[model samples]
Target: MTLLIETRELAVAAADSIVQPTSIRVRAGVPFTILGETGSGKTLLAQAIAGTLPDGLVARGEILIAGRPVQDLAVHERRALWGREIAILPQEPWLALDPTARSIDQVAEVYEVVRRRPADGARDDAVEAMRSLRLEGAGRKLPSELSGGMAQRVALAASRAGGARIMLADEPTKGLDAALRDGAIDLLREAMGSEGGLLTITHDISVPRRLGGEVAIMLAGRIIEQGPVEDVLQRPRHDYTRRLVAADPANWIRRIVPERFGDPVIEARGLAKFRGGRLLFSGLSLTIARGEIVGVVGPSGSGKSSLGDLVLGLIRPDAGSVRRDPRIAPLRFQKLYQDPPAAFAPQLTIRRALADLVARHRLDATRISDLMRRLRLSDGLLDRPPGAISGGELQRFALLRVLLLKPAFLFADEPTSRLDLITQQEMIELIVESAREEGCAVLLVSHDRDLIDKTADRVLALEGSWMDRDAVA
Candidate 1:
């Protein structure tokens, strides 16, 4: 086997504080995978290799691409290696996409500009890629118009557009359905092709299990366990690795559903909405009672978010109406966004942002400390900007702020899609517990049916023209 990318004693740090020293090597055809919880430095490792680390972070040690030493390379030299030698699929890739650019155009631009393909040929290749990913219908839609899953596919197309030999993929299945996830994985495997290499960082255990080659478990910015996938995952050695594997939701049998109920918090009747040039839903009626956990499960772009927005009155229904409790204020209704970074101010630290919210709402400042302790967040994280923390960490902060408002209803849209299995379980547990205590009506949307199965009291399934409701006992 030939080596494509190698890092020796590679370490990342902020100012003088170093996280951990890591070394990884990718062979010509085998995929190297890293599995870790959020904020465990998995993404930082990939970003270090790609030379795309966030602001205030620095990398040290040796980096080699295609047997060429590049750690000390100039900015332009390192940048020049992109597209031709190395390509990266960023976490939350949708955020990297141009909001105004059409999906196809974004992918095609990589071919035309980076690969130097002709305009006609670039577009044709992009079209083929999109078609293969089942995104043929989203070519003309803007990134904003596309669902998170569609945006993810589009990003994959763009990354592969340049035909890079060594690819670094971060959370490639962040927001994808199982079918789409398989397709994306297949594409990644194809990209490795005998002569190419792949380095993947993901929280999804199944990704490494299926890809199969080598796996490393990262914890607190260090690789605690590294070996063959089966050996590391099935017969784990480290205690943390053992807990991580055992924490998977797949192992859960069933969740306890409470019998206590409250008055209706909101009601929707004959609701209809047209989106993405199609009828999302028609004559849809549902009511959520206070203290109820309503789970919404659907494929991407199947109108899960749209339905939440409609019920929240963020958007007017085409043919029906949503009615809320006459005594409750509109501010009592909150939403936990799928993309955490987009929810906060880039210029402010977490502490400042939370304080501002408290002042604006006249909320008790003590609530922040109480909630932070419950969420297992450190006071140190509050001093950092939103972009400085991990997505999962930021999401917990989002939930903390929303809870401070004492919301009557919360629409959590794929709140755990980007989180590790442990974090996902913890957040859902907090949400359910809070609903019980606060009498908050929760309309939770997720691509993971298992999560919906465990956390939701009543499950609402939506995919295309299909709609079904079932009570979990």
Candidate 2:
């Protein structure tokens, strides 16, 4: 095995230093992973090494790629190596995909252009890649038409298509279900055969655990502790690392089913939804009472998010009806979207968006500050556009927006999917507390079975959208 990437005392800074000086090595046939929460500067460090840092921020120290000095190379010289020698898979899937392009075209473009393969051959290779990831049926859909999970798969396929020997995957498993996440892991592992290198940045501790690599624990912009994955994850020296491991849902002490509920806030009767030339679910019936947390779980593309949409009336069911309590205002029925950035105006700062809501609704302005504190959002983030912040932070901002409106029936679709284990637990706890205090009905959808089991009152299990298996446990 050879050294693929090495950063000696690499650090990134803006008005002030963000990612503190750090050093690490990525070797062929071995995975070197960085584990940290969002805003902990892990992503910033990766961006610096990849030569994709934002305009204002600057990086210092040495970066070597395959024994060549990356810093000394011209911009074009460095870019030519992308997808040929190394590839980057970003944290947000939407950033990697183009809205106007079909899934197949977006992926095939990499092969035809970057790899210089023939058109027909590129298309064939793209099709094969998507088929392996169970995205064969979504090839014709635009990036906007795909689900979060599907879009994520498309991004993975496109990134891996160039056959880059060195791969930098940032939160690659963030939006996927258990099965797809495992499939992605297998794919990355196979791609890094004997002489390839992998560097993954993720909060899902499971990635490093399964990938078998050297792991570093990062907090407050610094690597606090690092060693073999088994030692760092299984036995920790840092207090933050131990807390992060303990916060994994698998380690959570299961609570008994939540207390019984009261009157129904929303109900679905014999509902049927047809999508992508297939019936997602049929003859499905569900009811969420005020203050009750109902969990929905299934494989990727199996309609977990679709079910929430049905209940929210964002999309009408092909059959049957969704009836909301007549007493509650329509404005009170809100949703925390799966992708937070999609819900916000890109041009407006976070503060501007919230202020507009406050002014329009004639709501008290002081509540905004209080809720920001509750969500652990920094005052500085309020000034930046949605695209400027990390996905996890943007997600908490989404929750703050929804909670401000005081939703009576909240459809939380994978709200915490992009978050770290520590923040994930905190987000769930906040949701539960908000639901109870406001008598809000929550339809929470998740890919992790343990999470659904721990938080939901009763589970709605979907087996490929067949409601026959929709049994409450």
Worst 10 residues of 1 by lDDT: 464-473
Model 2 C-alpha lDDT per residue in residues 41-133, reported as the tens digit of each score: 999999888888888889999998888889767889878888988888888888789999899998899999988999999999898888887
Which ten residues in a row are the worst by lDDT in model 2?
A: 464-473
Give stretches of model 1 more than 4 Å off.
Answer: 465-473
The per-residue C-alpha lDDT of model 2 at residue 350 equals 91
Could you tell me how far off, in angstroms, the CA of residue 138 lies in candidate 2 after the best superposition?
Answer: 1.3
lDDT of each: 0.86, 0.88
Quality of model 1 by C-alpha lDDT: 0.86
